[model samples]
Target: MDTTLRHGPFVMQLGSMPVQNILVDKEWNIKQFIEVQSICSLPIELMLPPSWITGKDIDKLLSTEDDRLQICYRQFAHTLRHEEAKRPLLPNGRLHSDTLIDGLHSSKFWLLQALQSSGNPLHTFRRVKGYGDNYAGKGKPLAAAAFRPQIYDYLKYKIASYVDYRKDVQKLFNGEYGRVYDEEDLDYIRRRPIVPERK
Candidate 1:
């Protein structure tokens, strides 16, 4: 859409495509993966389009100035980056692609485990066959059936905020991360207390 913006180059082609076309396709794939992971890794109650918060979303309950919400947002974004950095590596030593279905399954499995260990009752939820099933299911829908609605909304907002922040950073820096936001700001975000007081 915005051809004026600079983008990083990718050498490989999907098939019969030129270098520019491949670059465009790669960029789109990256954005799609980010969006899918943003939705899939979160509780199912928060995965619906109606539950998603975007820059254009207006909500009376979600306030931009809320300190508690801001803390959660920062913590979530920091933790997401941390987890992504530690994703499983391929036999060739390259990090596994986030778009891969097996990788998605592994991510959800560990995510559920972490939630359970933290006293979350997410594991009680039944997993349902989701999109890309193709008669034989490759993955199950990530669900958190009994998770609190208000807390679910809060978590959804944090995820949406992080996704938006990442898109902005990637767009502004031409695929480079950690440049738009200063290192001190990132450190502050990462250093915030993991458990904030609920008020």
Candidate 2:
């Protein structure tokens, strides 16, 4: 089986890569992904530094006064802004579904992890509070309030089930996500307990 194919510079086809060979989670890898601008401007994107390096490392990098990690939330928070990120909700309220999808994929690994278990991270994009003129998420009754935490919460639920990932991770990695959660299956994961029921 040919495993390597290289194009000009952007396309490298690793044909039929096995499941386990793909999805991998490492603290250093996540931090590196952030530094590479590959996972920019998402909410959990801020937490990557702390998870990969140290929370103090983040404070140090963003700190101004005396370069002290002593206590600096403002600068640290500002680093997470990706130009359009802080834009206020439109006059009324609304989050474009496509924009929501962008936000979800921005945290690609996060979505992958979420799908590994019982959560559907993409659906949470609805919680982002869609409003204002021609709010794109309006007609798409699927998206919620456009809240970032909703996305994080879903991811957290999947991560919390760390006893081991569900075998379904394979099907998810196959990239048929849209088909797997067709409109009818959207909220299936929401009802699943975030944390396992205490025995």
Candidate 3:
């Protein structure tokens, strides 16, 4: 009956002398319980940026190089974020699981799209090899052995300071944030094969 004591889907109680409100549900569950004795209240904490921002940055970086390169980088970044987000947030400050899962999904989608668009065996092979190396670290040596000569030739003539960007990127993430995948996490990601088609 009192305006100060509001009740609808939820209840809110306000006092005149003391500026404070108590919120509760019909079941008496404390949906929100706040005590304000003064004119000021606790400062609100800011939310962290969505993990996808990193992936988007990588995409922008690669977009200027080559279409294929752009696609590969975008997919990789997206996949990594998606996968990381999907995982349950660990107390150890690792990435969120759901992010990683979603990132991987985006990566796979883009990878397939790039392959289809390029229709170049070498590019496809290199991209796949990169993805494989990222997880298993098995195909890297072979990919390097095969592609190094061409990559070297490409870099030799150009003055675009050549370096293992993948390694650099990984290191950057690790140093700034933390390890994206530990031994156990890698094993889990590897074991969960991405089916070609959704069932």
Candidate 4:
């Protein structure tokens, strides 16, 4: 409820709002999409309250040091920037408002191909445990059904540790995104104070 931080001309943060209200907000949703991709497949029902999550929930996943969520976001935004460095255009010549997790692997594979073909060394990301055992049909662990997105997280942390992520964030929120945000809004997000982790 603190209105001290300026987001655009207005001051705001992820204060207590209906979880759905925040989730469906195009700007917030697209920010998540550009970062995690298909990692979230929860239905619209689950995306709402009673089972809703908040910035705190997200913060739970990040605890690298003092400023985990901010660092995580920095990494995520930068990773997208790396992808943009390779393929500057979305397939449709427009930025997707909602990038469902579909074709996620194919996208990574091709991006890997493009980078490797261009002389980037074979970057072997560490393997993450699967979320379930649907893929464990041959007596494998149910965990094989899914894998943790630690690779992406680690990559984000590693890269952010080395390079500046604010520029990447600006590029994502300010660059060619289709009307989801303007320079001011992007600037607001970039400059918004990092919320402290709940004790």
Candidate 5:
């Protein structure tokens, strides 16, 4: 039997929900939600494993051209800095520990490496708990939640790209039939116009 799954923007071969829903909650605005979704649903072609033949593979990946992942790291760093700045003071109103800042920088480097080598953000970000926690209470420590100048901006930028990507993909597959008669016909079917005229 053939089945079709409908989402706000894109469809996949499988009937299960796309992973994006797990990342963004329903309360998020449509644009914010879809942007996260697009990043989550990026095609494999856009992701290529870097050659990890030497010292600190993660560092090498972040230094390379993949701007999308770079933005994510930048956001992560900004989040860390903001949180560190807000740490409970040592009576003199100064931060108690530099640990969080160090961790953020370190994690950013590793995350880039892991993503490049593994093509899995979860794997790359396993050490950092802020992205999302898989386990209920056994997750890694999260950076403190403090407002940073760049964190919101980077997040907004990434989310915007994600939204645009989702919109484009959804528009690309809006009104196609649920099932294809033949597997070989997919290319032709995808090329067919699926966008509906605005009413």
Candidate 6:
């Protein structure tokens, strides 16, 4: 009955077997596995502000002297850049996959909400064309053109699903994410609805 060995600083442990065999299969406390990082706060700023979420005119707010969007957008972009800069760069001058996932996690959350509601918060803030659209790669596939947004859309689909989103969010909090989808999965996701059937 000994839950003796702890994993790192987390409370997760391997329980000893009834027959006193240390070689027995490890029993994992799933609740502890989740609770290990439950204390960590989600990136609340990554979510759109209340006004934006409630269908207010974010573009007008951004245009006016009101600095809400300005301040929040600046912090969001700064955190994104900081996270990207901390990651190892690739030969193609792009940041690591971690940067891409972090960016998409934030982007998909904000953009999907905007797309479902009234205004385009991230798009208006960044002044990007079709930021969240073009999921099927409608145009050129080069660089950050249609291809990037397509991948972004795919990730958005993955995130919109509750089960997958929880896994990704857990990984996001843990500062690591495995591949959520593959090429075959992408083909199927593209054929499916843009907004996932579930939250």
By lDDT, who's the top model here?
6
Whole-model lDDT, model 4: 0.34
Clashes in each model (backbone N, CA, C under 3 Å)? 0, 19, 24, 7, 3, 0
Residue 126, candidate 4: Cα error in Å is 35
Scored by TM-score, the top model is 6
lDDT of each: 0.35, 0.33, 0.40, 0.34, 0.41, 0.42
Full ranking by TM-score: 6, 5, 1, 4, 3, 2
Q: What TM-score would candidate 5 get against the native?
A: 0.21
lDDT of 2 by residue, 103-126 (tens): 333543233322322344333222
lDDT value for model 3:
0.40
TM-score of each: 0.18, 0.15, 0.16, 0.17, 0.21, 0.21
For model 6, the superposed segments whose C-alpha errors exceed 4 Å read: 1-66, 88-91, 95-113, 118-199
Model 6, poorest ten-residue lDDT window? 1-10
Error of 1 at 144 (Å): 37
Ordered by lDDT, highest first, the candidates read 6, 5, 3, 1, 4, 2
Model 4 steric clash pairs: 38-101, 130-146, 130-147, 131-146, 132-142, 132-145, 133-142
Task: Kindly list the per-residue Cα lDDT of model 3 for residues 7-90, writing each as its tens digit.
Answer: 212312221111124477899565664664333221111111222233332223243444544455456545656665665223
Model 4 residue 17 lDDT score: 36
Q: Model 5, 1-199: lDDT tens per residue? A: 0012122223122212233433544774443322332234422112222223122344334434445554554455455457657663223443323332343444534443344443444444544434444422554222221122235456779999999998877865674435425666877788897898999
**Residue 143's lDDT in candidate 6:** 33
Clash count, candidate 5: 3
List the pairs of residues colliding in candidate 5. Answer: 35-162, 35-163, 58-113
Please tell me which model should have the higher lDDT, number 1 or number 6.
6
Per-residue CA lDDT of candidate 4, range 92-199, in tens? 342211221211222332222222232321221111123222222345322222233334455568788667666666667775445666789979989998899998
Give RMSD to native, each candidate: 26.3, 23.5, 27.2, 26.2, 24.1, 25.0
lDDT of 3 at 151: 50
Instruction: Give the poorly placed runs of model 1, Cα more than 4 Å off.
Output: 1-58, 62-65, 88-199
Candidate 6 residue 92 C-alpha distance from true site, Å: 3.1
Candidate 6 per-residue C-alpha lDDT over 15-108 given as tens digits, one digit per residue, 9 for 90 to 100: 2111122233356322222222223322222233333422344444443533555455456556655765776223344433333345444544
